[model samples]
Every structure is written in structure tokens, then in C-alpha cells.
Target chain A: MTIEYASIEQFYELIEPGLNSVELAVYAASITTFFALILVLYKRLHHDKLNTLPVNISGFGYAIPGTVLAMAMLATFGPLDNLINEWALSLNIEEPGLILSGTVFAIIFAFVVRFSAIANGTISGGVEQVAHSLDLAPLSLGMGSIKGIFKVHLPLLKSSIFVAWLLVFVEAMKELPAVLILRPFNYDTLSTQIYQLISDEQLEQGALGAISIVVFGLLPIIWLNKNEEKS
Target chain B: MTHLIDIQQLAVKLQNKTILSDVSLSLEAGDILGLVGPSGCGKTTLLNTIAGFIEQSAGKIVIDEKMQIDLTNLVAPEERNVGMIFQDYALFPHLTIRENIGFGLFNLDKATCNSRVTELMSLLKLTELAERYPHQLSGGQQQRVAIARALAPQPKIILLDEPFSNIDARLRNELMIEIRQLLKSLNMTAIFVTHNKDEVFTFADKVAVMSEGRILQFGSPVLVSQQPNSWQVADFLQLGSWIPVKCNGDSAETAIGSLTDVHTENCQTGKTESSIMSLLVKPQHIRIENNENVNVEINHVGITEQGYHYIVSSLNRTDLSFDRLSFYSHDVFQLGQQLAFEIIHHEYLMFDQAPPR
Candidate 1:
């Protein structure tokens, strides 16, 4: 079969999965980054051995193979789903089966666990650049701790937060193993679509999807380079 | 009148290490207290303790004789109604000058907040830069914004941690004078930390000299200078050179001359009769005695606004020898030149030599 010039047909076929990929990446990155910032703030304000526990555990996720992490996620949430279903049955209520085990929530949860270390490391490095006194200056001015963080810290961390979101978003877009194993039935993302076409020896048909993942992956790298140059 | 701030037996521990212990100080309304010490002397820790940033392991802090803070009744920093200006100024880089100054005024109505911010901006001569962010302003301008922000809420007492340290040395004195005058005009009670005793002399109504997590002395600058209570305080202040002397009855014999009618402070009663004592010999207390034998050799010479300044070492008296004897005169002296000098008759100030570290 001759490879034809790239056609819009392949691009048209990728629109649905591309949207799905964007949605998953956005949801996972937002939640992951939010929790990362909170963890950083907690560590800064409270000096305890336990402060590093959650970060360490989350960071450990990045070291695990994606397939293993997907299995772990299923193993963890699958039982919780069964427990909830049993409780519902006990109460004679309708069982909400597999609410977390094989849904978008599970995919997002896996992404968060897999990429939290990236967000935490980036945001933590940013927070370290800020003077510790900035944390107390607002408190001295009669602003509560929460408000002080919003007024002083969050603004200062804006670039770090953006970079972290971009990094996780890129990772989520290209992630294949975890998505392949955990994505709900009939729900296809760019990664899954690209993987399927390649498995079927129709790599040309998935060229647009593969290119889309690569382009998404380059965004944060380019943005980071520009920022490094600016700084 | 009740004191604006009364701290009693304040102590702080961080990571199982005691940072401050038995630190007590009181400041009246409108009085500016300067906390001066070498680095790691707990001046900043004391300030942080007062500002409620660091929890005290022991002791109590009373603000305006109304709010009392102790280990049992710890108050959060924001609710303490105290303000602090950090050494780095800690100005919010993202906020404009006006917005930074108005930050703590969130409790006030919009009209009140705007008025307060405007008034502070004018007072600090920052009206022209109100729209500029902290990073866009000069160090002095950023410091002024920090001051304005700390003062906006009208807290009972303000804590300033080396506020002028970031300023250019050439501008530091001028800025200190202006800020002191402004604080005086507002009748604001404040405590500022610095290692420069000169800053205290120029800006503080009261001075506290700290060493090794303890306040060695606290009094008016003149009083502390004239009657330093300990060897550490006198030595840290550079009040004078230490001349090893032996006390016999009412007089003390030194390498230079005998100081009669010695009045010793912090000198052990029985030990002073035989053991060596360090006399605080101010530069002005020494006079040239050309007719007498040369007793000191000039080691260092430098010019000052006062005149030729020389640091002389004892010539031959090893038992009573001393170095760094500061002397000022109109006559120039070469290094290594022997000179005749005698301690002028004055109220004697003596302290026991500090224990060796």
C-alpha cells in the first residue's frame, strides 16, 4: 500500500479522541496541581516528618511502570467500589456499580498519582525562591494565613503552577500504558487510538493522532525553554 | 501609664535548640527600642516572638496592657494586631505600592482603606510610585512600601527586623532619620533589630544589646554606653579597649597608669581584689603625656573626621599588656612609633574579663 500525502480524513477521525485526551489531561492536571500546591504550603508551615509522607508516596508513583500503576489503581478502587455496592445493597438502595473502578475518575486518579511528583517538585522549587518572611509579612499586617497565601504566595507561584499544569497535561496526553489499561470501555483517547492503529499495522491511519501527542508534548518543553531564557 | 509592650521571661526553642531564653523587655507608647547584636544573637528571634510568628516555649507577652500572650493562651499572628517589616522588606512583588500598603486594611471600608493608603503614601513620599509594583521600585522605595503596609493597620506596636539593612550605606543614615522622625510624628511604638549599634544611637530611644541568645544590656544609648554592665556588652559595643588591670583597695594598676577610686560593675566582689579586671578605657579617656616615658607603640593609624586615630599596643609590660587601645589626637603618629600616654582621671568603669569560649 502506498503512503498517500497526509489527508484531512485522518485528522477528522482523530477529533473525538483528541478532545477526550484534552479533557482527561485538563481534569487530571488541575486536580494534581491543586493538591501539590496545598502539600507544599503544608510542608512550609508545619515542619514535621509526616509532611513528606504524602509527597514521597505520590512521587513513588512516578517510578512505577504505568501498567503496574494502572493495576494498583484498579486493585485499590475496585474493592472500595465493592464495599460501597455491598453497603447500598444492605440499605436496599440501587447499587452504583464501578463508580471509580472503570470510569473517567479512575483515569484522572491514575494520572494524578503518576504525575503528582512533577507538579509538587516544580511548585515546591518555586515556593522555595520566595522569602520565608513573605509568609509572615502579611500575617503581621492582620491578614489571616489563608488570605496571605492567596495574596502573596499564589501570585508568586503563578508561573510554577502554569508550568506544572503544562508538564502534567503533556504527560497525560502521551501516556499510553496506563490509559490503555484503565480507560473505560468504548472511550478512546489519542494515545489509545494511536496504539490500536499501530497494533493493527495501520500506522499511517494513526499518523495524525501520533503527531498530535508529539505536538502536545513539545508545548511545555518549548514554553519552559522560553521561560528559562527570559529568567 | 501602662506599657505598650511587656514581655516577661520570653523563651523560644526551635528543633530542640533554644534560640532565646529569659528575654524580657518593655516598651512604652511612642518609644522606639533598638535590638542590637551580632549575628545569631536572638534579636530577630525576640522580634519574631513578639510578633507571634514563633511560639514561645515559656514566658508571656502583653500588648497594650490588654492582650496577653503566653504558652497557655497563644494568639495567632494576625489576631495579635502587631505589624512587622522584614529585613528584605518582604514587599509583595505582584502588588502595586498602593495595593501592598492597603493589604492589611481589608477589615476597613473601601473609603477608609483608600484614605489610609493615600495618607501613608504621601507620608512616605511614595505617592508618585503608588501604581508601581515592588520589583519595579528601588530598594528604598520598596522599604517605604513595607513600612507603609506595616503601619496601615495601626497596630499597637510594629516589629522591624533589620529594616534598613538592605538600604545603601550612603542612604542608610538619611533614611533612618526620616523614618524615625515619621514614627515619632505618628507616636508609633516600635522595635527594630540591627547589629549596628550606631543605628541604635541614631534612631532608638532605647537600646538592647544581645549576645548568645540573651540581652546583655538594655537602657538609653547614652546610659548603656557610659555604664555597660558586662564585658560582652562593652566589648561588643567597642566602647573602649580592654586594659588588664589588678585592683588593690580603691585603685586599679594598669600598663599605662593607675586608675584611682575604681568603681567596678559586674566585677565579682572578692575576686576583684586579686584577680585581673578589664577596664573600659574610652579613647577620650587617654591623653598624651610627652614628658612621661613612652608606654605604648602605635600599631595602626587611620584618619577620621575627628583627627588622626591610632590603635596602640602596650610597649613592654607583658603582665599588664593590652592591644587595641584607641587614641585620637591632632598629631600624626607612624605605625610602630612609641608614644607616651596616660589614662585621664574620670569615673572608672571596670568589668570582669569574659570567660573564654
Candidate 2:
């Protein structure tokens, strides 16, 4: 129950040693964010004339619950490291975070999952504004919609980006089940930091993290709500 | 040459409700067709359908004769080369006025786009507001920007759906005058959908009178106003006196009197061979004629501030009939005064009780 951090030489007593470095990287590569990113990419980049997938998949209503998603994340990523290493070899990428895994990758994938509707809504609203003004077809006016996202759309999305940044940041900060099962070795985020601290009888540190999150989270929630009201 | 824009048997069914049905009309070069109807009568629906925003359930929409596409197979709204000003003018709040007008001209060369934007800004007198966002502009300014944006693409047919409703009513008439002039100078073929009678009369070359998803009449504004086909139409256009009548083949007798000038009277009652029929009379055709031998019993006289009195005449036939027969004049008459009135002339149009035979 007592974990030692003072002496770097005594690491073997407190660690799961048999797992090698490559095996550890593979373990971190599979999780909710990885799978969620797949759904998000399909939703965003699909070019079908009739788009019914994004909404259906955003799981605005039909999402598998978080616990089930956690279970799925574990099963999908836990034993699938060999396949990941094999695929990673084909792509010639040494690091897994570039394509999948850990806090940064999980956050990226989680964002696309939890926030695609907002992204699509923002994009569609921009298109609608131009379409209606020019009497253009909302569909036919899809002129470089992909190119536009980087050129004209991103500039126009200042407010959207700021809001989305706060959402993704906070969600990634507070995410538990995904982060709990997906952190790299010796990594301590504020969310997992609080959960681990509390479990180890450090309630004050945990409470401080919880309090900081509440204070920071409340500000963005209010701002997001107000932005929506104005929009 | 074919008309600039043509629509035939266009029906728009949305959310299981028939918003518009079999409404066919066309706009020639330089023609401004005003689609006038009461609220929810499909005027806006028809305009949106023509602009390609709403898909038509049936019928053909031809643009410039060469692009004859049944709206069922319509080119998309953006590619249709049509323009529109919505009821609210729906200006983009984020874009500056200049950018808005320049948006649809994205295909043009940069120089061409700039010149077109400049020309439209001056054309709409929006030069001062060019840097402002839509929310910063006044209703009239926003309206002009909307028009300028729509017009920048030089669309074949401009569709204006209740364009002035968002503007101040006091400014609407003056703005309409400016818009009408601008459209003429540009030789723009437009369909202006509005419910206001005066707006339609003053702005449109032709009018389509509609109610309950049906166009009662469509023609030059004067024709639709002066010679509406039925009582429903007469009521919609605020035309004519709805005189009660009983008629047959030749002569029709209304509350006012009997008339034998039967040209095309379809009486709902009486034998077709008989000379008695019921018909409606135009208000302008019924007048106070003391010397012409037509008797009118006045039940009440309503006076306006301008000293003119509208006489509400009572029918001796119906006893308690409020026939709503009124005449415009400055001479105030007393209530219950039996006045001598007569048929103004042959302009009194009589209709059958129910149409056909």
C-alpha cells in the first residue's frame, strides 16, 4: 500500500516490471478516445449526399453509457497491443500518441466525439448564412467547405474555438474512466491526480483539485450558455 | 422568346401539408409579379419554391427557356442563378456589409468581385454601411444589403419574399419606390411576395391575388383590382359591393334593383330559361342617384374626420341586410335618411349564386 518515490534505484519493488517499454506503449494506444476518433473522422469527412451518420453516431441520445464505453475501451485496447505494433510498423511511426493513446490522444479523440455536433452546427450555420444571403443552395454552396474550414471558416470561428477549447480542456481534465485506464507510466493529471490522492488518504489535495475544477468549469459553462443565448 | 422565369402546376407539399398546389405563373423580361395573399396563404411558399429553396412536389419551372427543368429535377438553389430577399432579410451578422455582397461573387476574379461589390454598394446606397455588420445596420440598411448581396450575382430572377415587413411601415412605401426604381434600372425580373394591398399596387406591375393556398386571380394589378372574378376575390382585393341577387338566363335582380343587361350571368338559382338571377355588384357601379329613380333606404351614415359619410343602406327585400355598399364622398349624410340611389352604369357585374349552372 505504501509507494516509494524518494530513491530512483528502488523502482522494482513498486512496479509491474515484466511489461517492457514497447508493451507499455501498446497498452496506452487503445481506449475510448482512439475509437471515438474513428467515429469522428467518419462523421466529419464523409461525402455522402444524404448525411445521417454523424447525428446517429454522435450518440446525442443513443450513446453507449460511460461504464460500457470504459469496458469496451479496456477490451479493445488491453489485448490488442500486438495488432497496434504491427499496424504501427506499416505506418513507420515510432510513437503511438501521434495516432492514438494517453491523455493527449484520448482528449483529441474525446473532443471529436463529445463535440462533433457543436462543430457541425457551427459549420452548417456558417454555410446557411452565406447560402441564404446569396440565395445559394445550402447544398450546392459547399464550395471548398473543407478548404474553407481552414481559410475563412477558422477565422470566423474565433468564438467557437475559444468555447470549444474550454470544453475540451475541461472534459479532458475531468474525464475519469477513460483516463484512469489509459494514463502512461507515472503520469498524474488533476482528475486522476484527485482520484489517486483521495484513495491514498490525501483528502486535502483531492479537495483542492476538485475545488479548482469547479471554479474553472463554472466560468466556461456560463460563458458557453451566454454565447448560445446570443447566437 | 420565352418568359424569363416560368412555373407551371407547381405544388409544394411540406411536412404532410399542402402549402401550395398547382399554382402556375410566369414572369417575362422586366416583369415584376407581386404574389399577394393573406398570411399562410402560400405566397411565401410560392416565392421560396420559385427561388429553389423549397422543393416542389410537382410541375415544371423553366428559367430563360433554355434551362427548362421540372422543379422535381431542379438545379440546386445555389446553381439555379436565382436571387432572393427573405422576409427578415437574414443578413449575416458576422460579415461586414461589403463581404456579404461579395460572398456570392466568389467565382468572379478579385478585381471583378471588388468592382461588383462597389457598384452594388453605390446602387443600394450602402457605401457608408459597408464596414458595418448586419446587426449594426438599420432595418432599411439591412434590407438594402440583402438586396445588394442577392443582386451581386446578377441572378436571372430575383425573388423578394415579404421584403418590407421588417422595415418601418413609414419607410416601406418610400423604400418600395426606391427598390422598384432600382429593379427597373437593373432590368431585374422579380417576384415580390407581400400581403399589403398598397405595397403590391404601388410596387408590382402585375398581381396574383391568393387565399387559402389558391390564386384567385393573376394579372396586371389594375385588372385584378378592378375585375376580380368572384366574391371571394372581391373580398380579398377589397373590391366591389357584394349585392345579394336571384338570377337566371337573362336578367338578375339584386337587392339594389333588377338588371337586364345580361352578358354572361351564371345564376345558381331560378330556371336557366327564366330572366331572374342573383348576382354581386361592384361598389363603383352602385351610386346615389336621386334623379335616376333608384330608391335607397339609409339605415346609418358613418362619417370620417374628413367630413365624408359612408352610407349603410338597408334592403327592403331582406329587411335587416347590412349590404356593406359604400361610396366615397365628403358630403355627410344623416342616419335613417331615405336617399335616391341608382346603378352607376353598366359596370355593375352580377355573378351566379354558386357558379356554373
Candidate 3:
């Protein structure tokens, strides 16, 4: 088969899915990293051995393959969605069909579960580098714990949080298995669109999308290398 | 006047191990209490307990005569109105100096907060560095910012954990004096922890010597230095050398000399049956004799600001012999030189050979 360059119109056609992928990745990474930061702070400051169990559990998700995680999400949320629908039917109300299993929420949930370990590891290491006294100093100054975290810790953790977000975003952009399995019907991310083009033997058409994904993936590596050199 | 801070029977147990036990202390307003001890002796633990950073497993803490903290009625650190300066100063690296000092002033009006920040900046001589982050400043400057932040909220009491440990030795004393004057001017009651006894003498109005999770003695710096009540206190303070003494009837024999009327008044061994006691012999209590048997050989010599300091070991190879006998003199002494010395006739102070079990 001849490998002809795709027309500019075909490249422009991929922008919508590319933007959608960026948007989804941003939301999932932000939410996951925020919770990861809170979990880290709680584990460090509370000194509770039990708190570490949840952190360990969150990190265990990374060990699971993305395809397996997507399947697990479907297996878990499908039943819960059916139970909700059954309850609505019994009450003579309109059933929200496939609310979770057939929506973007499933894909986002799969991404969060898959990438939470990265966020947790990066953020927790950052928090550990901070002196424990930083936690107590604000408290001693009559600042409540929540406010102190936002004012004192979050500022100190800016670089770590940014790195975590970037890592998760890159991973989500490159992730095809989970997105292909869990993405809602009629919704297409860059990864899914590229997978479709490659499946249909239109490599030239998907080359632009493929390059965008690779470029996004290189962001965190470049940023991390720069930081390592600085330090 | 009511005590600004009162800790009664405070005990802290971490991970099933007792860190501090039955610790009690009281400080009136404007009082500076120094907690001095060896490493792992729980001085910093006591300071953290008082600051509400560590929960007391037993007893209660009263701050400003109103807030009482106990196991049943727990108060968070922020609500305790206690401020702290950590060993590393714990200054926020993200915030500028002005923002750091103004951190706790968030509850106040904007004008009041700005005014307080400005006031603390001027007071701490941080006005010029107000825009700089913690990493941009020197160690002393960071410490001043930490102090300013702690003082911004006008806390009921201040707790400092090894505040001067990170400071340059040359600047430590000067910083301590300046901070002491600032605390006194504000009439802010404070407790500071340090392993260095000299810091206590230079910085604290009262000194509490601690060992094994207990304050062995507490009093004015001079009193504690001159008349430590326990063997641990004297040994930890390096107040003097311990000379082994054996008591017989109304007299005691030492490696140095014998003393008549070795009554129980000056004896604090707490063990009546044990005849072996250790005498707390100060360096000034010893005098060189012109004609006598050489009883001590100089083992170590160093120059102090006052004069030459020598640590000599006993030449008499007997049960009563001891090492690390320290004294100072203007006359030079060789490292291996043997000398004759006698304990001057004075009030005798004796303690147990070891801490009371």
C-alpha cells in the first residue's frame, strides 16, 4: 500500500479529538493529584499506621495493567449502575441508563486508578523532603490545619504537584487500552482516534495524532531533566 | 500573678514507649525557662508537649489560666495560643519575609495584619529582607523571620526546640541575647530546649536539667550551676569532677584528702547503707601544694578564655582513684607532668555514685 501524506483538512479534523484528550487528561490528573496530596499529608502528619494502608492500596493500582483496570472498572460500576436503575424503576421514575458504565466518568475513573500511584509517589516524596516542623510551625502560629496546608504546604509543593500532574497527563494521553475500552459511545479521544486510523490501515492520517501524543509524553521528561540539572 | 504557662504531671508516650513522664513546670509571664539535657533525654519532647504538638498521655496543661489541656479535653495546637520556633526555623520558603510574619495574622483585619507585619519587620530588622524568601536569607535571617512569624499572633507562650542549634557558633550568643531582650520587652513567657548548658546560662532566667524523661533539678542558672542536687545534674552540667569517697563514722576518705564531720546534711546519696560516695569537687575548690606526693598526672590540657584547663587522672592506683579530674590554672603544666593538689576546706557536697534507682 502507498503511504501518501494526509491532507491538511484531515489533520485539522483530528483537533477536536486531540483537544478532548487534553481536557480529559487535565481533569483526571488534577483530581487524582489533589487527593493524592491530601492522602500523603494525612499519612505523614497523623502518624497513623492504618492511614498508610489506603496509600498502599492506592499505589497498588499502578501495578495492574491498564486493560485489566478498565475491565475492573466496568465490572464494578456496571452492577452499581444497574442497581440504581432498578431502584428508579421500582419508584416509577425515569431510569438513568448506563450513567456510569457508558459515560466519560468510567474513563476518568480508570485513568485516576491507573495513575494515582505516580501522583502519590511524587507528592509524598516532596512532602517528606519538607521538614516536619513546617507542619507544626503554622499550627503553633494559630493557623488551622487545613489553612496551613493550603498556605504553607501547597506552596512548597508547587513543583512536586506540577510534576505529578504532568506525569499523569502524559500517561493518560498515551493510554489507549483503557480509553478504547471505557470511552463513551460517540466520544473520541486522540488515542482512540489514532487506534481507529491504524486499524483501518490509514497510518498517514494517524501520524499527526501519533506525533502529538509523543510530544505530550516528552513534556514531563524534559521538565524533570531540567529540574535535575538545576538541583 | 498567675503563671502564664503551667504543665502538671505531663507525660507523653509514643508508640508504646514513654518519652516524657510526670513532668511538671510553671513559668510566669516574661520568664525564659531553658530545658537542657543530653541527646535523647526528652528535653525537646517536653518542649513539644507544652506546645501542644504532642498530646500528653497523662496530666493537664494550663495556658493563660483559662485554656486547660488534658486527655479528656484536648485542644489543638492552633487554639492553644502557643508559638514555636523549630530547630531549622521552619520558615516557609514560598512566602516572602513579610508574608511569613503575616501568616498567622490572617484572622485580623487587613490593616491590622499589614501593621503587625510591618511592626515585626522593623522589630526584627527584617524590613529590608521582607520581599525575600527563606532560602534567600542567611541562617540568622531565617531564624529572625521564624521568630517574627511566631510573635505576630501575640501567642500566650512561646516554645523553641533547639532554636540556636543551627546558628553559627559566633552568632549564637549574640542572637540569644537579642532574642532574650525581645522576649523580655514583650513580656512573653517562653521555654527553649537545648543540649548546650552554656546556652542556658547565657539565655535562660531559669534552667531545668533533664535526664531519662525527668527534670532532675530546676532553678536559677546560677543556683543550678553552683548547687546541682543530683549526680546526673552535676555530671551532665560538667559542673565538677567526681572524686570517690568512702565514709566511715563521722569522717570520709577521698583520693584527694580526708574530711571530718562528713555529716548527712551535705550527703545526697539517698543510700545510707552504701559507704562509697562521689564528691562533687569544683575546680576552684582545689589548690596546688608546693611539697607533697604527686597524686595526679595531667592527661589533657586545653586553653580556655579564663586560663589553661587541665584534666588529670589519679596517680594512686587504688579503688578510690578516678579520671577526668578537671582544674584551671595560670601556670602552665605539661601533659605528663605530675602535681600535688589538695581540696580546700569548705562545705562538702556528696552524691550517689550513680543515679538513684
Top lDDT model: 1
lDDT (tens digit, per residue) of candidate 3 on B1-357: 788888899889999999999888888999999999889989888888878788889998998899989999989888888889898898887788899899889899999999989999999999999888888999999999999999999988888888898999999999999999999999999899988988999899999999889889989999988788888988888888888887765678888777777665544343543377888889999999997688889999999987999999888878889887889999999999999989887667787665432
> In model 1, which regions exceed 4 Å deviation?
A1-9, A219-231, B265-270, B354-357
Instruction: Give the lDDT ranking, best first.
Output: 1, 3, 2
Residue by residue across B39-58, what tens digits does model 2's lDDT show? 88998888777766678888
Docking class of 1: high
Question: Evaluated with TM-score, which candidate comes out highest?
Answer: 1
Better of 1 and 3 by lDDT: 1
Which residue ranges in model 3 land beyond 4 Å of their true spot?
A1-4, A219-231, B264-274, B354-357
Predictions in order: lDDT: 0.88, 0.64, 0.87
DockQ preference between candidates 1 and 2, better one: 1
> In candidate 3, what are the lDDT values of residues A131-218, reduced to their tens digit?
9888888889888888988898898899999989988999888888998999888899999998998999988787878888888889
lDDT of 1 at B207: 95
What range of 10 consecutive residues in model 2 chain A has the weakest lDDT sum? A13-22
Candidates ranked, most accurate by DockQ first: 1, 3, 2
By summed lDDT, which 10 consecutive residues of candidate 2 chain B come out lowest? B348-357
Q: Give the per-residue Cα lDDT of candidate 2 at A209.
A: 57
TM-scores across all candidates? 0.96, 0.76, 0.94
